[model samples]
Target chain A: MLKIEGLRVELPGFALQDIHLEIANGDYFVLVGPSASGKTVLLETIAGMHRVSTGHIWLDQRDITGLEPERRQLGMVYQDCALFPHLSVAENIAFGLKVRGRPPSDIARQQERLVRLLDIGPLLARRTTRLSGGERQKVALARALMTDPEVLLLDEPLGALDPQTRENVREEIIKLHTELGLTIIHVTHDFEEAVAMGQNIAVIGAGAIRQVGPADEIFRHPDSEFVARFTMAVNVFPGRTEVGPAGTSTFVVADARLLTRSTVEGPCWAAIRPDSIQLVATSSEAGPDNRFTGQISRIINKGSVVEVTVDLPPAMTCLLTRHGFDQLDLAVGRPVCLVVPPAAVHLFQD
Target chain B: MSKHPGSQLRGKSRGGGQSLNWVFTLLGMLILLFILVPLFKMVFLSNKQALGQALLDPQTLSSIGLTIYAALIATAIGFVLGVPLAYLFARREFPGKGILEGLIDLPIVVPHSAAGIALLFVFGSNFLVGRGFKAVGIQFIDSLAGIVIAMLFVSVPILITSAKESFRKVDVRLEKVARTLGASPWQAFARVTFPLAWRSILAGSLMMWARGMSEFGAVIILAYHPTVAPILVYQRFETYGLAQAIPVAAIMIMISALVFIGVQTLLRRRDAGA
Candidate 1:
């Protein structure tokens, strides 16, 4: 288990304040945030590169806050794959073992294991400067894991690859995690990647973690406006909530009102995912509950799904499957009615 | 189509370009000749029989040997002290770092004779450092140690500046990665940083060694006895005139050029193999 309590690090023009986190052994956790959000700093601090201004870090019930990186027994792979250019791929992988003064036979055994596991057997004799981006990433991963560190910290590991290569490396990481039962902490700014690979995630913004929960919980229900916006929740509005008839909740934004099933009262913010709003023809006999009439302002084909922008009192974006869009024959400037179920709306107290 | 616009422009511009190219070629040849003419004249003017006799002379051989040996020792000393200081300056940022870097290059700009005079005051027989060394049974004046000290004082800045450039080219992230992968700070530097920067450091050592071999002003002031090749050449010129001095100078020049070319070729071949 790894635990960080009240960790604070101060760098130039950036600071991480009072960060608290806990990860169980063998869990795949991701730290997600926007650019320059201090994600990389936090990872480096955990790897013992940066000293904490305040707080303690505990690894496996031992306080390792003061240990050097070598003594901490943690491995880190940088975003740029900082491999030693002068060494061949085999030498690069064998570096850690050689530095630790392991016997030659033991070093060779571990090197062979990693080379086979990462499928880099053919690249062992090649120089590091000649490897492609994806090849370098594999070599870096092999080098990091050769030491059998307790926790492997990866900083944007797949952020530099093309789309097809990204998918391949992502699957490779997941396979390695399960096969080796390794505890991994991956950091990235892409939410889809987090949802795909992480069992639990911590959403960081402006140098602070706003929420930490399971992947589905973080995606479906965010705790703040900032978290909602960062997670691609398109329709978020600040409103005041009042108890309504039939045990429902009424949220009022400037001239618009939305009904929700949430029992929270007083001023609040409400958010709904773009895919949750359904669009129907204006003449459809939909119920009056949570229904609004609007004109379609724009329609965009987004490969797998079509995005339709509706101009209600406040503009809203809705996502539809290509088949659904073709069935409706949607076009710009067409009149439409939006159906938002009460259960789909999430309300958070301001 | 009959008169292509691109073809016409190329034809008109080609004539003007040829004259401009000729002017640059003439200027380049002038600079080249200026360097080569003196060397050719010296080699051709010296009588071959006299040059061979000078090469076989005992005094001449010992003087040339002492000069090369002292310069080699100076280069070794420079490498031992300058490499670590260069690495430190490249990796750390502290108050007055820029001023300290400028101070390292000061010896290069100072006049060599004036530099020898400054060293005389500090390491002369009567000075504190000189007395301290004398207590340990080592003398500097009129000794090989004095010649080496003079050469090192003037030539070490080249090594430091060149090593610093090589260290700067190495990425700090590579060292960090090594540290995280179970290597200590020293291990990372020895295995990664030093190997990556070795070529530049070797080139710098060559420059310092060559510069030390050619030093005359400082070595002459510090240690005039146990004459080096340059001092012997000066003495011959004064006593026997240009005829004797010409042959000795030509022999010295040939030896230095041969050594320089041989070492450079070995380094280039090693680089290609690596």
Candidate 2:
């Protein structure tokens, strides 16, 4: 297990304030944030490159905050695949082990195991300069894993590869995760990578983590407007609480209002993923549900889905599959109805 | 149809621009020949019979041997000290890095005689550094040791700048990765930076060595007693005119050229090892 309590670091544009996180022994944690949001700094700090201004990092119940990188037994793979150009692939994989004073006999066996496991057996004798991008990234990964580090940190591990290569590398990482069950902290600005790799996701912004939970929970229920906007929740608006039957709820701006899902009664903001919104043709629809009348302002093609930006009474935008859009024959100025259930509304303190 | 417009223009411009390339090429070759022909002439016109006698002469062989030995010593001194300084200059960005870099390049830009004079002042009997070293029973004036120091003064910049350029060409990310991979700072540098930049560093050392071997003005100014090869050549020229001096000059040229080519080939092999 790895835990950081009240982590703080001062950076040029941002300051990490009272940040906290926990990762189980085998959990794959993803730290997602915008560029220059101190994401890399935070990783480097945990890696022992940056000294924390305040806080303690506990690994497996031992405080290793003051330990150097080598002593901390933490492995890091950079975005650029920092392989030593002078060393052969085999030597690079054996570097950490040899540095730790491991016997040469033991190192040879370990190196062979890692080389075969990473599928870099053919590249063992080859110099690092000859490896492809994916090949280099694998070698870097294998090198880091050879040390048997307590936690493996990946900084945009697949950010440099082409689209097709990224998919293959992503699968390789997933396999590594399943086999090793290593505590992993992967950082990237990419949302899809977060969904694919992270069991737990921390939505970070500026410096502080705005929200943290299971990947599905954080996406289905963000804690702030920043996260909602970052996660492509395009239907956020200024809201207020009003008493209703049984209890109270929040309302979004349009000529119409939205139903609140939570019971906490205060002025709060709400976010809903684009896919949560359901759209239908306006045909005197009289259903016992949340609905809003609108005219389709535009139909934006987004690969497999068509995002319909509408000028409703509430001025809403919702995402629908291409099949749905084609069935509805969505066009500009076409009248439509939007339905958002209470369960889809995510509310946070204003 | 565009029927090779470029080819047509090429034909039209043949009389004017075509001759321009030929003219420049001839000028460049003339510059090359003008520089090299005299060197070739020195060897061709050398009296091998007299040179045989001169080679047997104690004074002549001693001077040539002194030149070769002094260059070896100067190269050793620079290799020991200049390389680390160059590496630091290339990698670090301290407050005074620019000033230090300028100081290293100053010797390369200054004339050899001026450098000899500067060294004389600093390592002279009365100056602080000179006095301090003299107190330790070391001296740098009119001695074989002085010749080595003077040669080093003129050629140290070549080694520093070349080694620094090689170090700078190596990516810093490689070093950072080594750190994360559990190698301490020294281990990281020895295993990575030094090896990768080894070829360029060797090339630079050879350049400085050759520069030191050919140095004349500095040796004359600082240490005229222990005559080096160039000083002997100068002495023969002044006394017996060009005939006697030409053979010694030819000998110096042949030896330095062979060493330069050998070093270049060795460096190429080192690069291939990478």
Candidate 3:
């Protein structure tokens, strides 16, 4: 287990404040954030590159806050895979073991195992500078793993690869994690990657962590407006909530009424995922939930899904499957009824 | 539409193209001839027998050997001291860093005679450093150590500046990765940073060695007895005039050219292999 308590790092023009996190052993944690959000700084601090202004890092019942990077036993892979260009693939993979003064036979054994595992046997003699992006990343991973570090810190490992290569490497990382049972902390900006790989996700923005929870819960029920928007929650609005009967609340947002499960009153923010808002024709209105009629103002086709914007009192965006969109024959200026279930509307105190 | 401005310029120049080409060629040839003429004249005027005699002379041969040896020692010292300082300057930020960098290049702009005088005050037999060395039975005045120190004082800036540039080209992230891979700071520098920057460091050493070989003013002030090649040439010129001095000077030039070509070829081969 690794724990960070009250971690704060100050850099010029940026600062990470009051970061508290706990990762169980063998857990796959993903840190998701926007660009320039201090994600990399936090990762580097954890890897012992930056000194924390105030914090204590505990790893497996030991306080390692003051340990040097090499003594900390944490391996890191950068986005660019900072491999030693002067060394060939085999030498690069053997670097960590050599640095630790491991026996030559042991180093050779580990090198061979990693080469076979990563399927980089043919590249053993090739210079690191000559490897492709994917090949370089694999060698970097192999090099980092050669020392058997307790935890692996990956800083946007797939951020530098094309789509096809990214998918392949993502699977490779998952396979390695399962086979080795090593604790992994991956940082990325893509929401899909976070959901696909992260068991638990931490959303960071503006030098502070907005929320941390299971990937599904954080995506479906965000705790703040920032988290909701960052997680692709398209229909978020500032509103006033009124406590109705029996612990139910009605939110008045831009002259539209939305029923939510929360009983909080006064000013608040209400959000619903784009995929949660249902579109129906005006003539076939469903049972009364929280329904509003509006004209379809825009239809944006995004490959597998279509994004539809509704011109209600306050415009709301909804994502629909291509088949659903085709069935409804949706077009610009068509009047439609948007049905948002009360349970799907998440309320946050503003 | 009005004629394009670019076409107008081209049209204006069209009539003068032939004369412009001739003028350019003439000026280019003039600069080439200015470099080639003196070199050709020196070789042509030196008697073949005198050239052979100068090459075989024990005094001339020893002087040339001493010059190369002292320069090599100075370059070695520069490599030992300057490389770390260059890497430090490249990777760290501190107060007065800019001024310190400027000071590294100060030796190049100062007059060599003045530089020699400055060295005399600090490294002379009576000075603190010289006396300290003398207590250990080592002498700087009129010694090979004095010659090397003089050469090093005048030529070390080339090594430091070139090394700093090379270190700058190496990404700091590579060193960080090495450190995270169970390597200590010293190990990271030795394993990753030094190898990556070796080519530039070698180039800088070559330049400093060449500069030290050609150094005359400072070495003459500090140690005149050792009789490096340049001082020997000056002595020959003073005693026997241009006729005797020409052959020795030509020999020195030829030696320097050969070494320069050899180093260039080695660097080319290394680059190709890499």
Candidate 4:
């Protein structure tokens, strides 16, 4: 297991607040945040690149916060791959062993294994500059893995590739992680990438982690307003919550009332994921549940999903599949009923 | 109907820009002629008898040899000491960094005679550094040591500036990757950074050596006995007439042209191959 406690790093005009995280052995954890949210800084710090102000990092029960990057035994792959241009692919892959003074036989053995594993046998003699993006990424991965580090840190490894190459390299990295069972910490800013690759996700905002859980939990039940907005839970309303006589609660905004399962009171923010809300015809909207009658203010086609904006005194956005959108024959200025389940309305204090 | 303002301006610029290209070419050709005419005349005007005599004279040949040798030594010393300092300037920021960088360019702007006097203050026989060296039976005044000191003082800035630019061109992330791959700091530099930047460093060294070989005022100030090629040409012009000086000047010109062409061809071929 790798653990970080009270991690704080200060840079000019930016600082990472006290951060604590734990990754179990052989687990795939993804740190997701927007640009300059301190994701790369935290990864570099864990790799022993930056100086820690007040922190303790333990890897497999050994204190390694003060160790050098080479002594820390962590593999790192950057977005650009950063393959040494001076060395050919074969020499680049063997650099770690060569620097360590390992025997030629041992170096050749490991080199052959990685070459076969990554299917880069033909590229061994080629220069790094001649390889394509996917080829370069694979070679960088093989080079990092040659050292057999205890943990692998990938800093947006697929951020620089084209769409098709990104997909191919993404699968290649997943295969490597599964085959080797290496503890991996991947950092990225793409939401779909985080959901697709990470077994556990951590959402960071403004240099502090806002939420950490399974992908579904973070998507459906964000713990803070920042997490909700970052995760694209678009229908968040600032309101005051009043506990009802029963177990449910009523969140009152300017002119709309939202029923939520949360029992918390006082001023708070209520988030309802766009995908969780359903659109029904206004004529049959007779149910007494959480339903609001509103006019469709805008219809935006976002490729696979359609974003429908409605004004129920307060404008709300809802997401629907293309099939559902086509079936509903929805259009701008049309009246519709929005059904938001009480369980879907997550409330959190400021 | 009036034309759109943006389209009218674009049309005017397009026509004017093409005519301006011809004017630029004319001005550029004038400067090229100004530089090449004198050099070409000097090389082509020398008679065969004087040229043969200049090559046969031991004094002229030895001065050329000594100039080349001292420049080589000074360039070697600069490479050993200046590369690390260049890397530091390229990669790190500390107190007085801006001033240090400005100071590296000092030798370039200062007059060669003034620079010679400044070196005399610090490295003269009575100064601290010169006295310490004299204790080891080494002297700088009117000797090969003094020639090398003058050459190095005037030429090292070229080397450091070029090397620093080369280091800046190399991505620092490459070294970071090497460190994560189990290489120490020094090993990362040797295996990664040095190889990437060595081409530019060599190009810079060639320039520094060429500049040092042609230095006149500084070397004359420190050592006039073991003469360099430029000083020999001057002495020939002063004692004899311009006729005697042309042969030695032509020989130095030939050597400079050969070295310059060789370095340029080498750099071009390497770039093409890479």
A40-121 per-residue lDDT for model 3 (tens digits) = 8888888888878998899999888888889999899999999888898889899998999999999999988988999999
Comparing to the true complex, what docking class would candidate 3 get? medium
Evaluate candidate 4 and give its CAPRI docking class based on DockQ: high
Across residues A57-119, which tens digit of lDDT does each residue of candidate 4 receive?
999999998999889889999999999887899999999889999999999999999999999
TM-score ranking, high to low: 4, 3, 1, 2
Cα-based lDDT at residue B155, candidate 4:
96
lDDT of 3 by residue, B133-152 (tens): 88898787789998999999
TM-score of each: 0.88, 0.87, 0.90, 0.96
Please provide, for model 1 over B62-167, each residue's C-alpha lDDT reduced to its tens digit, 9 standing for 90 to 100.
9989989999999999999999999989998788999999999998889998888888887888999988887898777889988999889999999999899989
Would you list the rank order by DockQ, best first?
Answer: 4, 3, 1, 2
Compared with the true structure, model 2 gives a TM-score of: 0.87
Off by over 4 Å in 3: A245-247, A281-288, A326-334, B1-47, B266-273
TM-score of 4: 0.96
> Model 2 - which docking category?
medium
Model 1 chain B: lowest-lDDT 10 consecutive positions: B265-274
* Model 2 per-residue lDDT tens digits across residues A1-350: 88999999875556788889988999999999989777887888888776688999999998978887767888889998888877889888898988778999989888888777788899989998898889989999999998888899999999999998898889888888888888889999987789878999998888888888999887887778888888878888767656678675746555656776766456777787778888888664634366777788887899899889878655678988888888887789878888888788777774
DockQ of each: 0.74, 0.52, 0.76, 0.83
